[model samples]
Target: MTWEEIAKAKKASVDDAIPSEWRLEKNPTANKVRNVGEYLDETLPARENSITSCTVTELAGKISRGELSAIEVTKAFCHRAALTHQLTTCCSEIFFERAYKKAEELDEYFKKNGKTVGPLHGVPISLKDQVNLEGIDSAIGYVSLVNKPKNKDEVSNIAKILENAGAVFYVKTTTPMAMMSGCTSSNIYGYTYNSYNRLLSSGGSSGGEGALIGARGSPLGFGTDIGGSIREPSCFHGLYGLRGCSNRLPYCNVTNSFAHAPVLASVIGPMAWDLDDLKLVTKLIIDSEPWMDDPKVPPIPWREVTDYPKKLCFAFVSDDGAARPHPPIERALQMCKDALVAQGHEVIDWEPPVSFIECRDLGASIYGADGYKEIADECAKSGEPIVREVMVLAGNGTDLPIGCSHVHEHWEQNKLRYEYQQKVDKYWKSTAQQTSTGRPVDAIITPLWETCSFKCEDIDMFSSAYSSTFNILDYAAVTTPVTTADKTLDSKDETYTPISDHDRAIHEYYDPELFHGTPVGLQVVTPRYEEERAIYLSGKLRDALSERR
Candidate 1:
C-alpha cells in the first residue's frame, strides 16, 4: 500500500481502539508554550530566582524546613513540564491531575508526621514510556501498543518504591518506535525536539526524558539505555543521566521489545538536572530492595564509599577511534580536560585498542537477530504503519526471519564480547603506570556521540559507537553536559576528508549554526556494577567543573 493509504488505515484503527470513556466530547485545551527563562519568571517569587537554579538536595532541604510545601513544589514542576512538552513534544502521557492529588497527600503526611515522607518526597519524577503505572498506558511509541490493557496489575517495582517514598508522578515520557534508533520519532508522537534548540533532535530512545529534565520540567526522571538511549539524549540536552548496570534496578513489568530474546547489556536508570539529584534518586531506588520483586535484579544494596584522593587520574578519548567528533564536541572534551587540570587532577590521552566498529556492528546484530519478524507481527496486529527507523532495522525490505543458525551465531558473538571485556579490564589496570598518584584513572571521559545532536533524517548517518562500546563491555556510563553548541566555533572543518560516504554524510549534518546552545555532553565510564563508584566519580567531575566556573 501507498504511504497515504497506510496513514489513513492507521488513523482509523486508533479511533476504533479508543475506549468509549476516553473518547473526547469536546476539544481539549490548547497547549501553552514557554522557554526556560519565561517559565521560571512566572512560577517563582522575586526572592526565589535561585529556585530554578537549585539542585534537588537544596529543594528537599527547603521542603523539610517547612519553607516550601509539597503541593507548591509539585505545581511548579507540572506547569514547567506541560510547557516543555508543548514546545518539544517530550511527553507521551500527562497526569497532572493525579500528580496534584499525590502532592496534596504528601503535604498532609508531612503536616501530620512532622517530618518528610521520604528522601524524594514532593519531587516530581518523569518516566520513559516503557515503565508501567497502574492505569497509564505503557506505549513505547507503537500505535499498536497504545490503549492495550495489561493482563495483570501494572504496578512496576520501581513505581511502587517511588510512590511509597513520596515521589509525585506527573508524566510518562515518549520514545522512538520500538526505541530501536538513537533519534526520537514515532508514528504515535511524530518527533521530539531539543528544548535548547528546536531544530535539533533530543536524542533517543530516552529523548523525551532528556528534554523534560533538561528544560527543568521535572527535577528527576528515569530512562533506559540499550545503545546510548539514555546517555546520548542526556548529553544532547545538557543533563546528568546514568546507564546503570543491567538488573541494578528492577525491570519486571516494564514493556520492552523481543521479550523472549535473551537479555543483552541494556539497563534502566535515572536522569536529572544535577549530579546530586541523580545520587538522591539512585540511592532511593537501590535502597528500596528491588530484587525482592524482580527475579532478574541482583540482591545488591547501595554502598556509601569514601571520597578518593584529592589528585585523581582520568583517561580521555575525544572519539571512539571510529569517527572523530564534531567541533562542538571536540571543544567540550578540551574544556573538560582543562577544567580537570586546573582543579589539580591528572589528565592523560587515552588510546584503547578496541575497535568501536566491531562493537556497534555486533550490537546491531544482537538487536536485529530476530530479523524483527516479531516486531512486524505486533505492528500488523494493530495495523499501525511501521516507522522509518524500524524499516531500517528490517533491512531494505528483506524482512526475512532469522533461523536457529543465526541465533547460534549470536551466541558465538556473545562469547567474543566476554573476551573483549577481559581485555578492557586489563587495559584499565595498566593505566596506573601513567598516573602521578600511581593508581589507575578514576573514570574514562569520552564523547557520547560524534555530533552534538542531529535532525530526524540525519540520525541514521551517525554511529552510536561512543556509548554503545561501553554497553558491549558492560561498563557503567554516566552522561554529563559540559557546554552548549557554539555555531561560530563549531563550524565544519573545510580541510576535513571523508573515510567513506557514511563518514562524509555524518559530517555534513553538522550545521553548528542550527545547533547553537544545544547541550554537548561527555560520558564517565567505570567497570560493570560499580554504580556507587560511578555516581561518586560523577559528583566529583561535576564539582570540579563548577569550581572552575
Candidate 2:
C-alpha cells in the first residue's frame, strides 16, 4: 500500500474501533463546535455527562464506595473519548472493548476481594501515542511506523505502573511525527485542534492529549515533555500539566525520538482538568517507587509540601527580553500578580542570571545536534514529506541542519546547558537577600506562550523561548489557567516597537478578535526535583485567583 493508503487505513481503524452507537451522527466543524466540552455537556446523556464531569479523585471515590461501577465509569469515558476524537481528531488508537474488559475484571476483583484494587482502581486514563501498549501501535504519526505493533516487553513503564494501580486505558492520543513539532499535525492524524476553540491549533507533541482532556474525554491523561510538549497543550486548553525535572517521572520503554541523546531528556507527567487530580496521579506514581523499575529515575519519594510562609514571595517574569507577550498573556500576568498581592504574597520581578534567549538557542542546538536525521530517515522510509510545522527543526525550513561535525561539539552543548542551570540556580538563591522573608522566592511564574494559542497554519511563526528555557534548566514546572483572551480587554499594542525580526513577527501576529475565547495560562516553576513544591505553589495561585473571582 502507498503511504497515503496506510495513513488513511490507520485513521479508519481508530474510527472503526468506536462502537457505532457512540459515533457522532454528524461531526461538527470548528466554526460550529468552538468548545467541545460544553457541546458534550449539553448533548450527552445525563449520567455520562455527570460521570465525565467529575474529577479523577471524585470518580475514584465513587467507584471505591460502590456508588459507581468500574464498567460504568469506563463506558462514560470511552463514549466521550469517541465523540471527542471525532470532533478534534485527538485520538490515535481507540479500543473501548479492551477498556470494558479490564473494567469488568476490576469490578470482579472488587466483588471477590471486598476492597478496591488500588488507589486508581477502575479510573480511566488516556495516554499519548508514544506510550507503548502490547499489540497497539505507538506509531506517533509516522506512516512508516503504521501496522507495527508493540510486544509485551515493549510496553511503557508508565502504562505498566498505571495498570498495576487498576487504571483502565481505552485510547492513545495523537502526536506529531517523531514527536518533534510544536503543533500536533502529521501525515497520519492531520491536526489536533484546541478543544475549547477548534479554530486554534492544539499545542503540540502532546496536542492530542491536551485536546482530549480539555474536552473531558478522560478524567486525566499523561503527556511527555522535553521542551514544553506537555505544558503548551495544557496551557492552550486551560488544563494543569506537569513537566517535572528530568527523570523525576519514569520514561522507561516510552517510544520517542532522540532516545539516545545524552545532552537532554524527556519527562512524562500528568495533565488534568483539576489540580487535585494532577496531584493525586503525580503522588501515586511517586509513591509507587517507580525508580525501582526505571533505573534512570531518582529514588526521590513524593514530598507532601504543606507548610509555606503565610506571606510568600514569588518571582514574576513578564517577558523573555526578546519577544514580548501578546495582550492576553500580559493581562494574565497582571491578574496573577494582583491576586498574589491581594493574598499578601510578594510579587517581585524576575531577572534571571542566564538569559532565556541563550537557553532557547542552546536548546535548539542540542535538539538539532544530530540534524534530525532520525526524523528524516523515518519519513523517508514511507516516502512522506516532513510536515511544514516541523520543518524548522531540520534547519531553515528548507534544508536539514548539518549535524555536529565532531563529538566535542555535542559535548560543548551539554556543557553550556549545565552552565546555564548553575547560573539560574545561583540567581534564585541570591533573591533571598531581596525578599522580605529572607528566603528565595517560593516560585517563578511566567507565560507559557506569547499568545494563548495561534491559528493552525501560523504555528511555524511562533517561538518556544517562553517554554523551552525551563527544559534547558531541568526545572519542575506546572501550567495553570488564569483567564481567557477577551477582545474587549486585550488589544494589540500598536505603540510597542519590535526588538528583533522574530519579535516583530510575533508582535504583528496578534489579533484580539482571532485569539479571543482561547485560554491564557502561565507556568509555575520550581527548582529541579521540586515537583511537590511546584504543585503546591500552583494550588496557592489558583486559590488566590479564585478569591479574586
Candidate 3:
C-alpha cells in the first residue's frame, strides 16, 4: 500500500480503538461540554481551588496542616492534568483511578498514624511514557511496541523509590517517536503544543512533561535527556529541569531509544515549576537509594552540605560559536550576568579549551548512529507521518541504518569523550585561582538554546552544544528561566555577521515577536555527580534573579 493509504488505515484503526467513553460528538458546540476547570470544581471538592497554581511544597504544607487530604490533592491534580492533556495532548495514559486509590490508602495511613506517609506524601507526579508502571503501555510513541503486555512486574526504579516515599502518580506523559527529536508529536497521541502559546512548539522529547508542568497540570514531573531533551523543553516552558549525572537516578527499568548502545549518555531527571520543588524531588529520590534497586545506579545519597559560601564565582558564556543564540537569548544571558555582578558574585567570561562544535557533532553521531532505522521500522508499523523535527534529522524515512560494525567506532568516540571531560575538569579547577572566593566557579551560566523554542524544522540545523556538552562530560546541569521572550529586548540584530551557514540559519529563524512570553532559560553547571550542589546552587541563582526582578 502507498504511505498515504497506510496513514489513512492507521487513523481509522486508532479511531475505532478509542473507548466509547472517550469519544466526542463530531463538530460539537461549546454548549456541549463544561470547561474542564469548572467541571472539576463541580465534581471534585479539592479542585474548588487551582491545584496547578501551587507548588509541591505549598501542597505538602496544606496536607500536613490537615487543610488538605491526600485524596483531595490527588483528585485536584488529576482534574487539572486531564484538562491539560485535552488542551496540549500531553498525556499518553490516564491513571486517575490508580492515583485516587493510592491517595485513599495514604489518607487511611495518616488517619491511623496521625502522620503523613513520607516527604512526597500526597504530591502528584507525572511520568514520561518510557517509565513503565505494571499494566500501562511503555510504547514511547512506537505503535509497534503498543499493547505488548509487561512480562514481569515492570516497576520503574524511580517509581519504586517515589512509591516508597509516598508520592502519588496521576498520569503518564507523552514523548516523541524514539524520543530523539526536539518536538513532541507521535502517531500514538498526536501533537503536543506549548501550553502558554499553543501555536508554537513546546520543545521536546520531554515536551509533554514541560507543557503539563508549565500549564500547572502537575507541579513536578520526570523527563530524560540525552541531548537537549529535558533542558530545552524546561527552558521553553519556563520550568526548572536538572539533567543530573548519568546513573544518579536509576534507569534500569526505563525504556529508551539507545537501549543497547554501549556509550550510555542519556539520563532521567526531575522537572518542576520552581527550583525548590526540583531540589525537594531530587533529594527525596536520591535519599531512597536507587542504587539498591538498579545495579547501574551509583551509591550517591542526598548530601546535606552547606559549604556554599555567601560569595560565588560564576562563568558566563552567551554564544558557543557553533550556533549563535538569538537576540533574546543573548540578552537573557547578559541580564543574568549583570544580576550576578550586582549581587556581588564574581563573573568571568569563559572560553572553553575545546570547541563545542566538535562535541556537538560527536554527540549526534553517537545518538543517531543507528540512523534511526529502529525508529523508522517502528513508525512503519504505526504508519504515522514522521514529525517535522525527526524528518529534518533523519530524513524522509529512506536513510539507511548504520551497520553493527560501527559499534567499534562508537566505542572509540566514548573514550575520546572521557578525555574531553577531563579537559573540562581542568578548566573548572583553574577557576579557583581567579576568584575572590578562593574556589572554582560554583557553576557556569549558559543559554539553554539559540532560540526560546525553534520552529520544528529548524531544530536539526540548530546546534544544541549548551546541554549536549554537559551530557558528554556527565556534568550536573540545572536550567532556570531568567526571562521570557521580550520583543523590545529581543529585536533582531540587523548588523549581525554569520558565524557559519548553520549559525546563519539559526539567526534567521529568530522572531522576537513570535517568541514573545516564551521562557528564556539559562543553565547552571556543576561538577559531575554533584547533583546536590547543582540543585542548591540553582536555588540560590533563582533567588538572586527573583530578587533583582
For 75-192, candidate 3 gives per-residue lDDT tens digits of: 7777667665666778777767788899999999988898887887888999988988887777787767776644456777788888777889978888887787888877666677
Residues 185-294 of candidate 2: C-alpha lDDT, one tens digit per residue? 99987989999999899989899999999999988999999889999999999999999998988999999988878889988999998999999999989998999999
For candidate 1, what is the lDDT?
0.77
- The numbered model that scores best in TM-score is 2
Clash count per candidate: 0, 0, 0
Note each model's CA RMSD in angstroms. Answer: 4.5, 1.2, 4.0
**For residues 152-206, could you state the per-residue lDDT of candidate 1 as single tens digits?**
4776778878878878888888898888778888877778877766667888989
Clashes of 1: 0
Candidate ranking (lDDT, best to worst): 2, 3, 1
lDDT of each: 0.77, 0.91, 0.78
Let me know the TM-score candidate 2 reaches against the reference structure. 0.98
Determine the C-alpha RMSD for candidate 2 after optimal superposition of all C-alphas.
1.2
Using alpha carbons, what is the TM-score of model 3? 0.90
